[model samples]
Target: MTQPSEGPAATGVPTCYRHPDRETWIRCQRCDKPICPDCMRDAAVGFQCPDCVREASKGSRQNRALYGGERSADPRLTSYVLIGINALVWLAIAATGGTKSRLADLLALRANGLCSPGDGYLYDIERRVCESTGSTFLPAVDDGAWWQLVTSVFTHVEIWHVAMNMFALFIFGPALEGIIGRARFLAVYLVSGLASSVLVLFLSSQYGSTVGASGALFGLLGALLVAARKARLNSQWLMQNLAIGVVITVVGWRMISWQGHLGGFLGGVVAAALIAYAPKEHRPLVQWGGLALVTLVLLGLTALRVSTLA
Candidate 1:
């Protein structure tokens, strides 16, 4: 053989740095190191070695929203999922019996039991008396119907009711999700719904039943308002809409569950404030911690209410 040249390529094919036994003609675009097919990772211009790829990833900053939330790839995804769930539930209720659906009875939030005296209407009555009258008895939160607190948020008896709430969700949900990210947006919705239920347990008549996504939608509205304020955008339109909602709630108090609306609004405000104003140095900690505290407070209030009802 001829005398060995100064360069390895002059004598033989270059070997991969990672796998010395494997020969390769390709060099890493980033580090210019010989790389075999197994060691190659595609990059903007050409293939890179694993080491170079890892180093580049480390140096790259992750994309985040203004409120310290991860930027969403599809902001409408979460809202669409929520809407789909509500729609499915609504269809189930309709297929069962609309207003008189047993599904509704099982899902609607009621603080105390009610008696249905074979008239398709419920009345507050003692279990003993209801049984004596041969009427059907329905249990409530006080009687271990705790699931109703969440189920009711997805329940609706009227087409118009579901339509209006879903329309509102479609309008506001994606916007807020884009700003705060999907996970935070979902948390705001659920916590707000729970808060609304708790307030309903305390404020509504024990005999009355409540249902609908109004609470969660109101929560989104509240969150959107806070986000707008934080972004220094004009919120006059939001304020006007809120005022209109307040008027509607006041006027329709006899028919609507104002307790749910107010509770959800308040919950959303607190949750959004915590998320939007969290310290940049410890954003996730402060945001999640504040939400947890709010949840605990709501639970404590629920426990207190349960004690009274029990």
Candidate 2:
């Protein structure tokens, strides 16, 4: 049998390279392959095929945030998640019991054991002394409730307390996430909270309990200040916020854990500095190493406090 003639119309009308059944006169500007509308991607000069678009993307450097983190598609997502967690914990505490909730008792950070004197009041005392007096002893961080260090960050009892913290997180969380990206933002938050707990462990009453996200929020404030300074951006708004925080901490010193706030702020400053000033040649290594070092230092402080309390 004679073979078909090889010419312009040798294969009949051209079809899409991806979908051979569909006939198309359009072709990719880059690869010159026949492409249908479905397979066509907008290019600088003309339409390009999906394969060419993907291949071009592979060779291009990824866009990163100001602090050398992957740009988040939705910077607000992490904040939303954190808010939801806090809300859920608060609801759980409320359902169990408001300020006197057992859940709150379990979650709040206390450096040492507490004893109930049968009058709905807690007093700091040794477990043996409490037991000898037929009083109820509540375990604390020194008593092996170590999880409180982190849990207290998410636990809150008073309506105003949780509302204020969540509001702060809502205001500042997304902006920080957008600047540093999700992972680094979360790192700053948790590390700041932990530092706050560490300070409470040492500076606050061993018998007194502490809980709330203020430490982490204070941390975000500090991080924002450092980040703005490093990026050479205007930071008047940040300074105002910091001023407000300082006023609140000072005014509420009797009722609030000022030590926690101080610890968190310092932690955030150090964390953001590490992230923003990391060497570009080895940015990830240096940034992560610095954060890890800070965490270890906080943990070491916590251990030392625990030893002293023990």
Candidate 3:
């Protein structure tokens, strides 16, 4: 095996070679060598000098820190915030009657006096393709209303739907976000939501106005799985959580859209892996590439939806 490329400059030490009377060493707590940080072995708490290597015993509290100054993980707080946002949106939908024209009438989109308003995130399959009734809520396929993807996440038909979605989001999202920091976590959440929607719109057989944060919630789970792996974590706990998701998904298939869940899960996984694990230099490329891929997929799904209608 090739040795590290340490030049002669590293062989000599500014550290006192032989401290007779004037010099002493704090020594690295680990290796015990009198090394400055430049030569210090990696440790969780403080530098480890070379001589202490054989004697050092370590505890694990060092590696798993998530927030400020060695604070405990805060996935719980993250979950509650997500639940609150989704719950607010769910209440908005509930205020309106869960009907095609009613939602359209409320959201303010009308076509040929056929547009219904209120807050249904999607037009059902029959409405999406067989009819051209307008929607105040569902953005036009070609319009620049990118907010649709984001807002769509908040639109759920019933209390239990949003509640379940928010519950899962509360569990997984905070954990994942805590690992990646607020900004990265936000990216994972939003992009995964869009990815999930695009995937459903592309492959789903049913098309009734659909909306929920479940896609983002699934994305958080995916990100948590990937991040755990990268962090060299023992993922048994997270794996069990994922199993719960799988069970809930299969059992609830008639009520929740599996296509959206799957799409969102996959999107979250890809986005998290790409963002969380990429080298610093490559992060920008990964982010832009994700945006481009999701945008293209969204466009393609729209085309397919329109074609089916025609």
lDDT of each: 0.87, 0.90, 0.60
lDDT per residue for candidate 1 within 58-79, as digits (tens), equals 5354556668767788989998
Q: Could you tell me which 10 consecutive residues in candidate 2 have the lowest summed lDDT?
A: 1-10
Pick the lDDT winner.
2
Kindly report which residue stretches of model 1 are placed more than 4 angstroms away from their true locations once superposed. 1-62, 126-134
- Better-scoring candidate (TM-score), 1 or 2: 2
Off by over 4 Å in 3: 1-81, 98-147, 284-310
What does candidate 3's lDDT look like per residue over 159-263, in tens digits?
Answer: 667677776776676677667666567677887887776666566543243567877778888888888888788889878877887898899888676777887
The superposed Cα distance between candidate 2 and the true structure at residue 89, in angstroms, equals: 1.1
lDDT of 2 by residue, 1-310 (tens): 2223233332689977777666789999998999977888999998999899988875454657776878888999999999999999999999998987888989999988899867978877788999999988887999989899999999999989999999999999999999999999999999999999999888898889999999999999999999999999999999999999999999999999999999999989989999999989999999999999999998888889999987
lDDT of candidate model 3 versus the reference: 0.60
Q: How high a TM-score does candidate 3 get? A: 0.60
Error of 2 at 232 (Å): 1.2
Name every residue pair that clashes in candidate 2.
Answer: none
TM-score of each: 0.81, 0.85, 0.60
